[model samples]
Target chain A: MRIPLGRKIVTYFLLSTAALLVFMPTLMAVVMSFMTNQDIMTGSFPSAFSLDNYRRAFEQFSLMHYVINSLFVSIIIMIGQLVLSSLAAYAFVFLEFKGRDFLFYLFIATMMVPFEASIIPNFHTIRDLGWIDQYTGLTVPFFAMAFGTFLLRQNFKQIPKELREASQIAGMGEVKFYLTVVLPVAKTSLITLGVYGFLTSWNMYLWPLLATTNDSVRTVQIGLRQLQSQEQMNDWGMIMSGAVIVIIPTLILLFLGQKKLQRGLTEGALK
Target chain B: MTEAAATLSQEDYILFEQTKRKHRYKQFIKGMLFLLPSIVLFSVFLFYPLLRTIYLSFFLTDASGAPTVFIGWDNFVTLFQSSIFQQSIKSTFLFVLYTVPLTIVVSLFLAIIANEKLRGIGFFRTIFSSGMGISVAAASVFWLYLFHPTIGFLNIILDTFRLEKISWLTDPSWALIAISVTTIWMNIGFTFLILLGGLQSMDKYLYESADVDGAGYFYKLRRITIPMLSPTLFFVVTVTIINAFQTFGQVDILTQGGPQNATNFIVYSIYREAFTNYQFGSASAQAIILFIIILIMTIIQFKLGERKVHYQ
Candidate 1:
């Protein structure tokens, strides 16, 4: 169908405007990060770029520790989620068991309950377990993801049953079939879940903040917030630099992981 | 295919698969064992905290980190009585009022526009959606500079337009609006993506059918789009309401609920009471209130959603 010219122009205008508005802060942050303290205080864009803000951010904040911590957490989260979620999803798909559907739905039901409902009890549990101020406390709780398992199970369920039957007829054990066949087939879903796991782990704020009082275990998010809250004058340049530093890795990861995200989305969308 | 099926007896297949099937069941049990950690984690970490938080609401706290007195609904009563708490409610309600429907409408508009067969749509979607990755605290700090009175970019624009300068973070009247705008900008992309996803999945035949009936774009939108998009709309609204209630980080970072507590939200109040004042009981009470509000709102949304949403 031929679309009207006016609607076309309007659509383009609105989309570009929305895009610019969404991007304005990051753009401004990039500009502000290079400016000196004087430029930031004076509210003037720097005529020439300086490395002072980056230097200060690195030296004073020890931002690297937080970034490295965030990376460590994200990596562990991804690996743990990939292995655990895929295994659960695989079992749900090919395994015929009593109460399977009920249990699977129960897992999905947890997704509807907001984190607020869980926080108070979780705090006590962590306190009881003496896991507070520990990385295990931070990572262990999120290692099982119902959403990831659900997504992967949907993909895994699509595999031909004959493939499993054929493997069995050829004297392959169910474990071997799952390892060799089911896993490789669902690799894309696993990657997608890994991306999601990484993002959630990286962007996590409240739980990590609550769980770990130790400064050493603080993620980039906590570090950035801490830097902002320090009673010193608002150092826009350093803060923006910190924001940039925090954001860059995610951006790079997103770029590489976009294909996975899209693929996973398309697969889920097909449902 | 028929010959291959005939060559393999159904009995042989069932028997061959029987051991595998039983083993698969065992594997399923083992998988649940792997899933057990996450299940136990969420139950302990999430459900337990929630219950404890609720329990903490009935008591009063002294400086010694203990509940000194049993105050039956006193905290709730006090929460309603305090002008500050009232102000927070008003602030949080105002935030929801401004952010929720506006965000839904604005994002829907953006999604509809983006969903069209336009060139470079993917790039625009990516740019807008990138905002979702940035934390609320980070966005607030960025906006603090952008909305700054003297050196801020917003002021620069306002000055050029001969408009009076607006103190975004500091001024009582404008702080909520300022924060709301930033919140909307930060979250609009998320709802936009969701609506876009919904829009993309819609069957094209509906539009074709609308065209056959001589429906204009608006008619098609009102009739076909709105009804079909309601599920996504419901999801967006539900999530946004939850998010809006938890508006602590931005308030903490940007305004600190300052300039006469103009932007003090409910969650921020809880945070301050618990951590800042170390009034653990009172803080826990405030958190319980917050939880109750969230729980009620969510249930209402879901209940209303079941009735209201019409899938095509």
Candidate 2:
């Protein structure tokens, strides 16, 4: 069953090429970010490295403001979704009430309806609430997520029933038990949900675009688009630098929570 | 004494029933309290918007984005008649057709290649998975650099190969293709990981048995591996179709629905109609149409999958 040398070499060659293709664009972006405008225009490797592009990206495009906006929106949405979904999941897992199963199924059904279908009405709702161009508009609608609820509910159901009974006998209130015991026991899944929520919120484009018109509330994704459109074909280095800045946080998140992110993604499919 | 004992038992039973009722009421209240936040959010954001969209689809709206006139079925009729909407439908399906199958095939191939247990395989997996780190906006910007007609990396490579420099974004024919390429590259990481997971989780004893049967790699893959991996493949296909149908970020950033509406995907079409043109009624209709299309596609996939996918 030993593989032939030729076939093995071919497999390695193909895999390496595929891997290179995947990595090359990000690598190029990083390389181009430090290059001068002239070097980028000429499509040559940089002879001299400088921070000019990053400087231009910040000053010209107001990249820092957009970064802050994106961070603010993503963090708020992450925490909000985590809190709300976990509470909802806890009820579904531990509490018994009439129509509980029905309500849970209804919540799950929301996942089937894509956000695009509801954007028009959502826009009107946000506007009517006087929330447009505000952080509330950007973050509030996304605060409760069906996917997060489902993921947490699955994990919470796996927690032992005896633990709940023991906590009850110990005179621990439901809130206290949830905060101290349930959350800690389901920490990994919660982390997974958090990472997923952050990434999705950070990468959000359409909702933010529809909800915000002013520079004051624009997220990084929309900001990058504006930068690209405004700088169209003029300063490639600056634009690539903007791109680099936009992806850095997400890349860091991926690095820090690779396992959680992987599990979260596969969780949807496997279930 | 017997009469006193009967009275005591009756009091105890009445007390037990009262406490049970009280406890049930308390549990109900507690559960509702815990669920209140999600209920409020979902009602406002998801359920209300969904029903409103359907309602808006049948009525013409004013400039302030409020439904003004009862235009029963007019929006849908106009949408069906409009050449732009038709083109959008065509372009969206084209985009899906171009992207989903190619992505599945390419990712499956990469997964197979990366499935080998070799030294430094973890590094390769990281490299292959790196695209997952890039946001759509970021990826579009990076690709915008590469897709530049003159002095871009792609054109430079084309020059080296003695090929003509193609206008990747501006040309109508190439615009969708360019966007599709960018999407495929960005999506490779996720699909690859899923397929890789599927491949790795496959039972090794099957392969060992195949080897004992004198089956070659291709034979084993075709007979054993593919059937075993069908469940994962089904999942990937379903997810990919849904994702491809909702493609917006790339089209919005790269082509803005295009040079000649060649890259006008369904979501982008809805966006342009609702926001840019202020045609809420039309947009809602289009949105509903898109929703139905996705629902039908999902149902069809599941139906087809049930027949083909071998769940172990």
Candidate 3:
């Protein structure tokens, strides 16, 4: 249906403003990151841009350690979630059992419980398990993600059951059938889950900050916030640089996986 | 030949029975095994912690800073007596009141506009979703610069329109609104993405049918789009509710719960108690109460969703 000119104009205006709302802060942040400390204090752009703030951020803070730590944790989380969720999703989809539906519902039910509620006691659980200031505490709790399982299970369900039967007729066992038949069909959702897991883990702030008290174990987001607080005055340039440092990779992944994410998020969030 | 036939038939029967037994055993093992990780993680992380929190809430810490005695309602009583706690509750609700509806409406409008079959729509979609890749803390810091009173871009724009400078984050009354505006801007991207997915996933056949019946645009939207979109709407609202209540990072970075604790959300308050003051006992109590509140709100959402949200 063709929209009226008046409605089209209004839509265009609204969309332009929406885009502005999204871009204004990012543009400002990028511009501010290039400013010097003197420029920031004087409330204007510097006569010449310099890398001094970036240098200060690196020297004063263990910025590189936090970046590497966050990367290590996120990579581990992505791999761990991909392996476990795929295996579990394969089992749920291809292997028929007496109580399959019941188990799937149980998995879905856990997704409703917010992480905030879980964190308090889960913190003590980590403490009891002697994982404080350890990467295991960061990665282990996310091994059995209900949403990832659901995403992969939905993808696996799309395959024809006859394919599994065809593999069986060729004398293939269950695990081999899953490897040959099911895994190939589930490639996209698995990739989607991997990206989602990586990005989510990369951006997480509160949980890791609360779990570890030491500087050596902080994530990038926490590192930036810590740097912001430690400075004698808020250095817009350094803080913006820190923000840019943390966000670049996630942005790349989001761009690469936008198609699959669009599908996964809609399907996952829908019924 | 006869002897071979007899042996073959007998062996086939035995083999069939053995395979059946093995399948049964494997099914049992696989069922439990598939559930094993989830059961372990949920039990250790979710259930155990929940029970521990409940236990901790009722106990008082000793002089040694360990939980020692069953204080039994003392935490709850103290919470009621504290004006700051009461204020946090009010602030939290007010924050939710400002953000939730605005976010839903703004994102929904953007989704509708972006979902149109206009040229250059993908570029517009990407621009709107750019905020999703930025961290909340980073976004708040950026907003701080944008809302700078004297030389900020916002002031420059307002001056062009002959308006006086508004101290967005500094003024007490407008501080929450300023924080809220930033929250809405940072958050609307995800909500818009979800809603756009819903809009695109919708069957085109429904619109064609409505058109055949001479349905107007608003009519189709109201009668068809809204009802079909309820499931997505419900999901977005659920996420928004959880995010709104636990909005810690933005308040921490932008306002620091400032201007007389206007933005001191319950989660931040809990953080300050536990980390800043080392009042672990009180913090745990606050966390437990916050959990109960979220649980109740979620239950109510589920109940409402069952009646209104359409799955298919």
- Which residue ranges in model 2 land beyond 4 Å of their true spot? A1-8, B1-15, B298-310
Best by lDDT: 2
Q: Would candidate 1 be rated incorrect, acceptable, medium or high by CAPRI criteria?
A: acceptable
What TM-score results for chain B in every one of the models? 0.85, 0.92, 0.85
Q: What's the DockQ of model 3?
A: 0.54
Better of 1 and 3 by TM-score: 3
lDDT of 3 by residue, B222-286 (tens): 99998898888887998898889878888887788877888888888887876677665677788
Tens digit of per-residue lDDT, candidate 2, span B1-312: 999999999999999999999999999999999999999999999889888999999999997778999989999999999999999999988988999999999889888888887767777877777777788999998888889889778999999999999999999999999999999998887888788888877799988988888998899889998889888888888888899999999988888998899999999999899888999999999999988887787676657757653457
Off by over 4 Å in 1: A1-7, A96-102, A167-174, A231-234, A256-271, B1-34, B60-74, B212-214, B300-310
Clashing pairs in 3: none
Candidates in descending lDDT order = 2, 3, 1
DockQ score of each predicted structure, in the order shown: 0.42, 0.72, 0.54
State the lDDT at B161 in candidate 3: 98
Best-to-worst ranking by TM-score: 2, 3, 1
Tens digits of per-residue lDDT for model 1 on A84-157? 67767876787766677887876755655566544555665677788887778788777777777778889888
lDDT of 2 by residue, A112-221 (tens): 78888889899998999999999999999998788888888888989999999999999999899899999999999988888878988998888898888889989988
